[model samples]
Target: MTVVNKLTRLLNITYPIIQGGMGNISDPNLAAAISNAGGLGTIGVGDLPINEAVYKVTEMLKQTSNPCCVNIPIAVHPNVSHIVQQMINLKVPVVSLSAGNPAPFISLLQQHKIIVICVIATVRQAKKAEKAGADIIVCEGYEAAGINAKNESTTMTLIPQVVQQVNIPVVAAGGIADGKGLAAALALGASGVQMGTRFIATKEAPYHKIYKQAIIQATDESTVIVGRRYNRIRRLIRSEYASKLLEIENKNDDPAIFFKQTTENYHKIGAFDGDIKNGFINGGQIAGLIEDCPSVYDLLETMTADAKQILKQSLEKLE
Candidate 1:
């Protein structure tokens, strides 16, 4: 049998697995698919308005009676109050927060009885989230795709440290794509794992064909860190734009010009065309490990099976 924890029990899910709330990519269809496969699916509504956020939640619920979560990046979207209220009104069972504090909104949501999970990049932020009333803290590492903190910490060094500091359940993120990672995180005192890049590579994700192919073909050395000068570091697959960004950064180019050039192509290539070479391929180093694009069920099953095998092998050694 697969291991179960208090978090899994609380969320009424069979596995302590969750799909990370990735903006633009993690929508109702993708979120519902993850939940249907027995993991918590999170809808990222940071880019959407309050009305659209509510509609997205409603549509996700309609997809599966199984519970799902909605992630709100407080700093990027100022409609968190409305989003939280919408969650309460719509009765969303779980809500995850990133990029900002959830304190002011926590009480409001807790009053309606919502499970709150906060994404933290540092031990200090983890402690702050706990004090601010986060039910669970997700320690996202520097290896993760998307916007990572400037003072990025690797998951290997950060997970156990965050676990040691926070009394609440800690979910490990960044570069985790398979059962080996799941087992390692559990061993490090993490209750579960939250994965984004791995899921994006799956068939369920709404990424463009080019984007998915890029992930499939990528290796550890295929990605580069960009936008560090602006204090908003993101990991993207090494491409034309990525190379140019690095070149500009190395030249010590103007910050404003650098940001404009980098972001200008993000939507044109990634969002619209899915051109891997010129588009935004936000992904973790795990891109190197993912060789095939499997269905969500296949991936989850393999992870659970592998984790159980690892546990069994460890016990055999004890005997």
Candidate 2:
């Protein structure tokens, strides 16, 4: 079992692991499985309408008695207040806000006794979230999949800075896939680690086999950063579609075509329909480390075990 810590206690989870709210193609079954297995699972609210998101939350809640988190990208979804109200009405155990300023909604969620975790990429933003009544801070780095923070801080560099600056628990995200990565985050004084790309390769994720296989087959050089020219930096797996997207982003300064090609529908096409020719998949640099597709339970079990061993070995070596 993972050692008791502020994060686990705060989130009411056995492990200090939080799943990233993988937008659009998020699976309720996959989220519930992670929650049931001791980690905090999140239902990603991409651009889905409020009703559709509510349905997903309901399905995820029905499958797991444990606490679950709903990850909502504040700026991506048009109806932020409506969704927040739905979350309160549903009495969700946790809510993670990202892709926009969370200060406005933090107090509202706290009023209803809902735990709030803000995903940030800089120390200033981390402190801002804490000041805004956020219960936890998930500091994301540039190496993470999908849309990254505008500041582009690395998890290794951002974690300690956020921890030193914020009084609340800090969860390190970006480029983390296994136990050793978790151990490194803890060593940097983070309370836990949040993973996205790693969980996508799990058995319960319900994504396309081709997507999972791509993750398994990925190498250190397999991923590339796109959308930089349009000021929307995102990490994506290097594929024909991804390359095409990058080409458009580079040659075309106008965001019209780039935005059209990288919408939620395209993401679903790549992640769920396994269409790489016309759709692109999101992945982190950690994809290189994912060699197998295990069940969520087994993945968590092995990670905690490995983290414990790795920490112990490091301590011994220090002595």
Candidate 3:
């Protein structure tokens, strides 16, 4: 039997997989590549302005005929309305919202009849998102990379709780790299799976080579959380900068100083300059599971094939 749902049918993808949108990582190239590979690809326009976002959407659409998604994290940035209207005007297939309740933007996108998916870290947040007219709810665990909510929850516990509370389809994320994780998420009542760290190890991702290498050589404890005072806690790879940040926090030092120092150099040291030592590596615990960097197509093929095999075997054992 085929495991299909509104996501698969609406996105017209063979696998019920959605590429987790990572800021500065999920660009037009990577997004199109994943969609072309038979999964829902997502471009993170959470930080971009409306004009740039429109250009990006047009560029990405030119790359693939398949459906793709655009992510907007409304809590951090200004011009949320402009971005939402731009996405609607472009007719983007899907919009995945993170870091805030999507209720306010629901009506804006609904007018265009756009499909909306909201990312949540807790069951309460999931219920809120579903009530806000989210077509799909992605339950992200504490193990995820990048910016996460202060009230972080593990996917193993959060997924079942969210599935029980919401009638909409749930997609599980955080520390998912291979088929075993995918199968486990499905067994927990998620209709699909979303992964960011796994895709960062792909060749199409625009992140620096050093960042990808760091992901490959990382361990379960390689990640640390920082930036709590700003109401945004980010899980980043443990580097010299991250270590310093922790030291300051441990001593109960001023968060403003840490935020200033990090904001001043985090992007330059990590993204633009690719300074792996002083730079902050935004990644998840799943980085430890990845060894080699492959094309997005190859990665999806392996994941889907292995997941099918494992799931089929489990059913056979029951028989």
Candidate 4:
């Protein structure tokens, strides 16, 4: 069953699900797999050098002809301008910007006929992104993994407010892991959904087996937020390293120390190297909901089928 909406029509995808660009984990294999499976796959170029980032995108393009997206963490990428130029040169179909004002580059991307989606965590940010000419808005709530907004609004509250504030299509993120969550997002007035933590547990994801297993075993209380003192709050699966990092953060340790703990290198160590004791893995409260590591195609198929059933049942209830 196809879940069509503004997002699907705009992107020409079979489903409205957009895979979260989980930095190092969003490699070509997984991105292409997701895109090939009918959803928009994303390659996250979080702080990667321009050449390497371009190589990843190029590899993904080679693997699949379907539309895919590249995520640019503006605040962390040292060469935002160069990255955008590369995406334009490659004729990338979609781009999602996060962690900074997207006003400067939104027009530039749109000029090249690229669909730009801005990730926002607040109603004000949604309005600003829409005004900046963003084709779509992905409202990420506090329950999301990785870096989150200081205000920490949950998806249930943030999606409706953003939908009310923006005329453009809205994609809900954070704490959403299954078909039930997708139905809830649609009920909240969102046209689509973005998933990160749940995707991390998929077989195609480049993260280590241990990382995927952790997600399967995680409980509702298994996650924790670190770096609150520095205002760069991040959610992660609680582990020895994360606990220590939290200890330092709680003590009001040097900001640099806290910063070092959350760098991309540590993320790679935990996610790719499976160094759970000394490295940290990003995860959301949705970790508790994942049960297995299925292929991307199987997962999306199941999710879409389940969503249709859930939505149909919900409508029957109202009747």
Candidate 5:
């Protein structure tokens, strides 16, 4: 039996699973792998130059004929217009905007007939995004890795609230790693689910072996939020570098100091180079649930199958 929803029909994918566009980690190979597996793959262009972003998208296009998405964190990238134009020029099928308002660029992307998905953390933001012409809303909760909203809403609370507030399809994000999580999101009225940390441990992901190992070895307490004191909340694996950053944050260090520690360079070193001592790795609370590295195909196939069985069992119990 196939599960279908607005999200699946909108993107024309076989599954409602979306690969979270992790900066530096969302490479062409990984994106193509997920897309080829009948899920939405996203290429994350976090603060990269417009030309580089175009090149990455171009490379992704060459890998798979399947539809892929390009994610633009509006707050970090300076030339938003240029990047949007590049996507339009390339005929990218979908675009996901995050970290800032989508009102300004929504119409431009819509004009090109590209499906626009806005990442929001609050009911107010979800409503605003819908009004601003977002084709879909990805309700990312605080349990997610990287920058999170100050309200710190969990996926359980945020997904249902956003679904109730918006008419558009709501894709649940954060703290979702398995078929059980997928079933829970569906129960909460989410049309689909997006995963970040869970995908990091996959074989197709370009992250270093050690980074994947860290996720597999993580426990419920192995991850912690580091930048809360500075108001730039981010969840990361508990490491010497992360611990040091937390210690400095507690001491009320300069914002610049904290900013330096959280730069993309550090992310590259830790995530790509496996330099855990000098760099930190970003992960979500769901990291604790990951046990092995599988190919994207195997992961998604098993997840969907498990979700079908679990949901079926749940319905029988209700009867």
Candidate 6:
């Protein structure tokens, strides 16, 4: 009946369910709600200015005394060093680093007693993060939303390999949105699960109503892969905008025009403004599994309860 494990204990949360960082469209209220609900809520800073990112993190901290994490895309942020220093200054209890090498900052953050969680899409990256002294590993598969690895590995196949490759606790991400998914991840040796698309469908996620609805109505084939030709490798819900982006990729080898349309500003237009025609919104393949836009607390609670039940049932059936 216990969901308590290395990840929950390490992060000092009630469950190991985590919300993936949403980059530029990051919201503090959503992050706070998750933290207040006894899970490690993460505020994604994406490519935000250092001041803005600090303001968001500070606001989330004010809303909840519970330990929360900040996600920084290390390689892309304009203020990488400054943001890293700000996270240290703000004393953000946990920090998740992605899209870049975490080696340089892992020890520095740990020196301040901040727990480091590295998000990687490949086995090699997971091992490297562990060696770089990451306390946890968030192994995201190609089924995840937004930018992905060029190889497009799935969570089902990736998690166990990463769990075996890294010594630290591994949190499975991509294509996980329910208790069944949670049960599956644990069975695969993952210490926990991180969900992005599922979070967007929740009441607290701050995405446009239309954006959330899109997740609720999504089907397995609703998600399409773009940028494969140019090595951008992102997953998003199929849309006129997505099709146009794909068309560009197919027609031209250079991704300059495609990259322009896929920037965070464009993402903001879809996620916040509900402009689906011109802006692209990120969604994972797991969108097919979501049916309702529950509160974050309800989502986590049900996930843990159901996971426990399913795990017990699965063991009995197997035996």
List per-prediction Cα lDDT, in the order shown.
0.83, 0.92, 0.82, 0.91, 0.90, 0.91
How many angstroms is residue 21 displaced in model 5 relative to the true structure, after the best TM-score fit? Answer: 1.4
Badly placed stretches (over 4 Å) of model 5 are: none
Better of 3 and 6 by lDDT: 6
lDDT of 5 by residue, 1-319 (tens): 3568888989999888998988755688889999999999999999887777888899999999998999999988888878888899999999999999889999999898999999999999999999999999999998898778999999999898889888999999999888999989999999989998998998888889999999999999988898877888888998888988888898866878898888888888899999988888999999999999999988888888888899999999999
lDDT of 4 by residue, 1-319 (tens): 6877888999999988998878755689899999999999999999988888999999999999999999998998998999999999999999999989999999999999999999999999999999989999999999999989999999999999889888999999999988999989998999989999988888888888999999999999989998888988999999988998988888865899788777888898899999978789999999999999999988888888888899999999999
Better of 1 and 6 by TM-score: 6
Kindly list the per-residue Cα lDDT of model 1 for residues 138-180, writing each as its tens digit: 8999999877888879998999999999899999999899999
* Tens digit per residue, CA lDDT, model 2, 1-319: 8659999998889988999999988889999999999999999989998889999999999999999999989999989899999999999999999999998999899899999999998888888889988999999988899998667788888888889988999999998999999999999999889999999989888989999999999999899998888888889999999989988987997898899999999999999999999898999999999999999999898898899899999999999
Can you write out model 6's per-residue Cα lDDT over 161-234, one digit (the tens) per residue?
Answer: 99887789999999999999999999999999998899898888888998998889999899998888778888
Per-residue lDDT of 189 in model 2 = 96
How much is the lDDT of residue 57 in candidate 5? Answer: 90
Compare the candidates by lDDT and give the number of the best one: 2
Candidate 4 has an lDDT of 0.91
lDDT of 1 at 281: 68
Q: How well does model 5 score by local distance difference test? A: 0.90
Q: How far is 203's C-alpha from truth in model 4 (Å)?
A: 1.6
Q: Where does candidate 6 stray beyond 4 Å? A: none
**In model 5, which range of ten residues has the least summed lDDT?**
1-10
CA deviation > 4 Å runs, candidate 4: none
Question: C-alpha displacement of 100 in model 6, angstroms?
Answer: 1.0
| C-alpha-based local distance difference test score of model 6 | 0.91
Worst 10 residues of 3 by lDDT: 263-272
